[model samples]
Target: MTWPKKYGGQERSFLDRYVVTEEFRVANAPVRAHFTADRQSGPVLLKYAADEIKKDVLPRITRGECCFCIGMSEPNSGSDLFAASTKATKTDEGWRVNGTKLWTSNAHHADYMIGLFRTSPSTEENHRHGLTNFLVDITLPGISISPVHNMAGLHEFNEVVFDDCLVPNNHVLGEINGAWKQATSELAYERSGPERFLETFYILTEMVRTLGTEPDNRSAEGIGRLVAQAHTLRRMSVSVNGMLQAGMEPVLEGAIVKDMGTVWEQALPRKARDLTAFTDIGNRTNFDRLLRYAIHIAPKLTIQGGTTEVLRSIIARGLGLR
Candidate 1:
């Protein structure tokens, strides 16, 4: 995937595009390495990774020099992100962060972390107002990252421990305790993409292969239904991207994309399991490995970007819920 050339630095949505179909699935590569950089870190950095940070870190993201991980989840807080407990204190040299962060996917290999921290103590009226975003170096002193294996049988996720680690004031993103405002835009980038709905696309192709021009009613009907749902998700995702490019935060639409994408992603595996009924069906079809992997890993997709339950709350709020 060559970096699309920037047209006046407004390339988030460059209109017409042609990406490889499911044929690219069999060539599955370890995207976890660049997951944070491309997915989360890039958007945030375009705003905050200034000067030296941009020169030193941005270019290396493509060459695999700077790996990144999200720091929103915590030992005490997962879906309820306002419940985060990690703290960053002002120090003479910089800010010193402390506390443990849970469900920090791929932190072990991350060069930098876009972590959430408490810049100011939370108050009754300021519960979600004290959190801030920081770009912390995992290599900084007093910082440690440990792997947390996911049920998908992958070691990409990790737990990051911050024990008095130093992060210069330059690392602070947005304003102090103004993370919620930053998140409205940050999440637009996070939620407005095709990756969420298309992770299991490999197996979707595999099902097509197994059917081989002729299929049963169950398979035929299911495939058509899945295709229509996926197409709808893609259009919604593209619309959100258009909103993003227009310099507006499509919060409600973003929540919808994530919620629908995750739901459809979760369905891919159950459908695959039905199509494939063997522990080891290598000899039975060309898609056995792909199907097996999808069946095991599909469930994690919903929870990875955000859990189904958590995202639904956002959707409900979008619908005017308190």
Candidate 2:
């Protein structure tokens, strides 16, 4: 809803989009299908893509007919994006990309990927150089996606291999070998959002319902604490969104939100399990099932988007603590 009217959006405020996103999370909507496009890809294009590319892709994204995935992590790169070895050599035709991207979510169903590739060698003074962002059409030849199932046995992750994949020059986003600027700025949008913390919100709601009204002291205390933490996170996230709306990048604030939010969501299942241990909610099969699923998926929360270690480093640097 934040795009211009000519781009099929209502030209609404970022706050409007924020409310809709939170409601979708609360309702457990299956928004993953087009979430990356709406949240990150569309904005990236609006800021960096050529007018022709934006005209062609933004409308499709707005129509919910396109899916986009991020291609950043590699086989051994982990959270250090500069260590990525994905090679994208300029060719007569365009650019020939060759490398593997690991832990890419929604890759199997994505129509495009905003991929990071090495276009030159990093100099002695700047290791962040040589990396560039490219808009890749997933349907291009030599692009292969292999499923990487999580502990929950869900196929939300994949390993994408680009074997001599050809991308036109027009597909480049922003300056060549200057993606570091774009990448850092992009994190504010990527890291601070409702989805970062609401992945396991269903379990919280189910726990509350299972506890029923007039729950015991222990249950009441636990519920209150969790709700209070969630409320604080929402307030922080809202403030960050306001910054984004004002064309300001809250990189430090965004990293803090993701780090704290992911940690909380990851621990939620175990806390809920502990809270419900002595309760008679064993008869609540739905709660039992959800708790089990949440536990299975909790371990990956802090690893996605960015790892806890990486986020802490960002936070420390932002605070001049490191």
Give me the candidate number with maximum lDDT.
Answer: 2
lDDT of 1 at 252: 79
Q: Provide the clashing-pair count of each candidate structure.
A: 0, 0
Query: Could you give candidate 2's per-residue lDDT for residues 1-322 as a string of tens digits?
Result: 9898888888999888989999998887899889999988898899999999989999999998999999989998978889889999999999999999999999999999999999999889999999999999999999999999987889998999999999999999999999998887789888999888888999899999888887999999999999999999989999999999899989999999999999999999999999888878447888999899989989989998899999999999998998
Q: What is the lDDT of residue 189 in candidate 2?
A: 85
Model 2, residue pairs in steric clash:
none
lDDT of 1 by residue, 245-311 (tens): 6778888788889888878887886876675453342354557766777878876778876787878
Which 10-residue span in candidate 1 carries the lowest summed lDDT?
1-10
lDDT (Cα) of model 2? 0.92
Q: In model 2, where is the ten-residue run with the lowest total lDDT?
A: 277-286
RMSD of each: 3.3, 1.2
Give the Cα lDDT of each candidate: 0.74, 0.92
Model 2: residues >4 Å from true position, as ranges?
none
How far residue 89's Cα lies from its native spot in candidate 2, in Å, is 0.7
lDDT of 1: 0.74
- Name the best candidate (by TM-score): 2
